[model samples]
Target: MKRFPIGILEFLTWTIALTGLFFFARVEGPHAGLCPIANLGLTWCPGCGLGRSIHLFLRGDFLASWEMHPMGSFAVLVIVWRQFELLYLIKKQLKSWQTY
Candidate 1:
């Protein structure tokens, strides 16, 4: 197997970390200081409201999630799929290296 890129691992780490933070916020209620765009004094962001939407979707409130952000559920699904793909690649690489 070819060497796995360090950057890919870094990216995957951040993605997983952010997803964990989202779940934490969902359980702990809204963390007002968490949104970088809002903290930067921006009135709007392309991903504004997505966190709330995802939380709702995770809690089985799909309709409310869609009302908050039309594509929130789909975005979460894609993120999950990407994470799985990354993990699969990492596992395959390790297995091949062990055999060699």
Candidate 2:
């Protein structure tokens, strides 16, 4: 089997994450009602409100974002870092393959 520089599954996962972020940032208010846990009679889960928080953070509402979820900004930073790392890994893999 032959493998390309970037795998389809990995590319799709990042694309989905970015797409979700784009929509979340544009939508108003907390959309947590769509969460399965919310429907399961749980008022709040550990990850509850994180999506809105991230959206707020992306919209420059840092204080409001932190108020919604303290780790929201951190999570965003981590996601960005992960993307960079993925690119780096792909580059390294391609370089190694070229030496074969």
Off by over 4 Å in 1: 1-22, 26-45
Candidate 2 clashes: the total is 0
User: What TM-score fits each model?
Assistant: 0.64, 0.73
- For every model shown, the clashing-pair count is 0, 0
lDDT of 1 by residue, 1-100 (tens): 4686434775567587556646664524455666788889998877777877887777788998898788889977887787777777777767778887
Candidate 1 clashing pairs, residues 3+ apart or interchain? none
- Lowest-lDDT window of 10 residues in candidate 1? 21-30
Clashes of 1: 0
lDDT of 2 by residue, 1-100 (tens): 4477774457568768766875655445444466788789888887877877888887788998899889989988887777788888887877888777
